[model samples]
Target: MEETISLKENYEIVKKRIWLILSITIIAALISALVSLFVLTPIYQSSTQILVNNSESEISGFDINDIRTNTELISTYSVIIKSPAILDIVIEELELNRSSGVLSSQINVKPENNSQVVSIIVQDANPTLAAEIANTIARVFKTEIVALMNVDNVSVLAEATVSEKPSPIKPNPTLNIAIAIVVGLMSGVGLSFLLEYLDNTVKTEQDVEKLLELPVLGSISQIKEQEENAFVSSQQNQPVGSVTIES
Candidate 1:
């Protein structure tokens, strides 16, 4: 036989586990808050901008095709800026003990879309270090571009400054808490159903009827202590001759 459950029945099942859901949600929210606020370390980001321009001011004997060629090569500059060649110099200049690959990971270089500008972003635990890395990377890229490409058009548009307050770049607490709450609620509801499935005891007349296919005739109410005491007192006050047994 196919077993079907109604919406009301499903609701009743969930209602039975309300306390479990609430407890899990609360615990998950607390854990997420603690991990986000205390356990995780905050990272700060700093960025610098460099402007790419055509150094040929006079345009003397400079073909428009040459200008197009240079414009198309902007992407090449972006890649070179992030290369080990430029990053190695920046690392050496800063006397950073980190390897070139690690330093490269800390730097992000990208050029504006069809525009003559590149943005370099650096992330580090210390705001000052982040700013220093950004500035040094930009400066080193500028010098290297002039020497390698013979283009003095690269100029530092903006230098990253040390932030007065450290801004966290990851592990957003609000978002994390929200996710945790959702996960906790789902887990709690699932666990509640799992427990309900494991429990085999029948506590209600409805369960008895369902299992034994028996109809309930009547229910006997349990006598309270006060009612029992009153009956005993009435019997004790009655005379011995007044008590008679009916056949």
Candidate 2:
């Protein structure tokens, strides 16, 4: 015969270990909150906007073809901006001790859609350094592109600035705690079920019936120490019976 478990049985299993489940979940959330608050490093991000414009457009007036050309060149500009050709100068100018490969990993270049504007984004542990790196990268790219591509159109539109109260872009404690809670709850439930399955001792009539596959004829009630002592005292306090003989 196929065996099956009802919803009541599942509820009972979870109820039996409710405290264990709750303890594990609470501990997991607390650990996650602590790590997010103190253990993980906060990474701050800064971005600088650079515009790719046709210098001749100012003299010769605006043209759609020039705009399209500048927009198309943005893809190439993005690559060059991250290449050693540009980052090397940026590092040297800023006197950064890190190598180009490491610095390049921290930088991201993105071009605005259908526009001749490119954004240089950098992330660092220090907010001030993040802003400084972003601005330095834009400046270095603008100067070097003129020499490398023979174009004098690139200009810094907005420089990255550090706010008085800059917030880190990641390590959100709320999100981490939320995820930890879910994971912990799932783990607790799984462990609860596992422990229930591994336990073979029968503590209830249902367990005995299930294990033996037989109906119970009777069961003995368990008496506590206090109840047993009370029974003995009542028996001793009873008057001794005297037998009377008929004369």
Candidate 3:
């Protein structure tokens, strides 16, 4: 038969298995920490910003409509930044041991909203190489776009550089541990509830009364074996009803 439980009983069940729940949470956190610190590869990222022409002053001999056109052309320029027209030259200039496709995969281009500024970002296992790629891609894209479009509109706004201490941008350890802790706690509580639901043994007089629908005439109290033996010996040695019994 099935029965409903109150919040107090649920709380008691969890309290009884609190250690198991805590152990699961700790194990999950430790595994996440280990993977974030040692197992996963560290990827370093660098970014460089460039500017697209918004005025004829930035590029000689252009009218107001041309300025708007150039601003709209920013999206096309973003695509060309990763194309072989730019990346092939970049690979040859830096003597990098990667194909144009592979090098392009590590780079990202982003343009400012309703503005002429563009940002180039690159990621690599080596920190110095990441910065070098970011800077070189911007230079090559700027020079190549001039030749391709017959306009001098691109300019470097900020260059990517390596600091004294560089940090990877992926596999955030603390965040990972926090998520694992929440998941582990939820799993443990669910398992505790499931186990409690599966248990059907009668453990109390109330359970018997409810299941059988009858009054309990009496109950046999439990006694330890040593105490029972001692009580029996004492009873055997004592007189019953104030009359000595012969053995």
In what order do the candidates fall by lDDT, top score first?
A: 2, 3, 1
lDDT scores in order: 0.83, 0.91, 0.87
Root-mean-square deviation per candidate:
4.7, 4.8, 5.0
Provide the TM-score for each candidate, comma-separated: 0.78, 0.87, 0.78
Poorly placed runs, candidate 1 (over 4 Å): 1-5, 56-71, 205-247
Backbone clash tally (model 3): 0
Off by over 4 Å in 3: 1-5, 54-67, 205-247
Candidate topping lDDT: 2
Q: Rank the models by TM-score, top first.
A: 2, 3, 1
C-alpha lDDT of residue 172 in model 1 = 90
Q: Quote model 1's TM-score.
A: 0.78
Q: Encode model 2's per-residue lDDT on 54-145: one tens digit a residue.
A: 97446777789889998999999999999999888888988999999999999999887768989999999999999999998888888888
Q: Which window of 10 residues has the lowest lDDT sum in candidate 1? A: 1-10
The CA lDDT at 48 in model 3 is 97
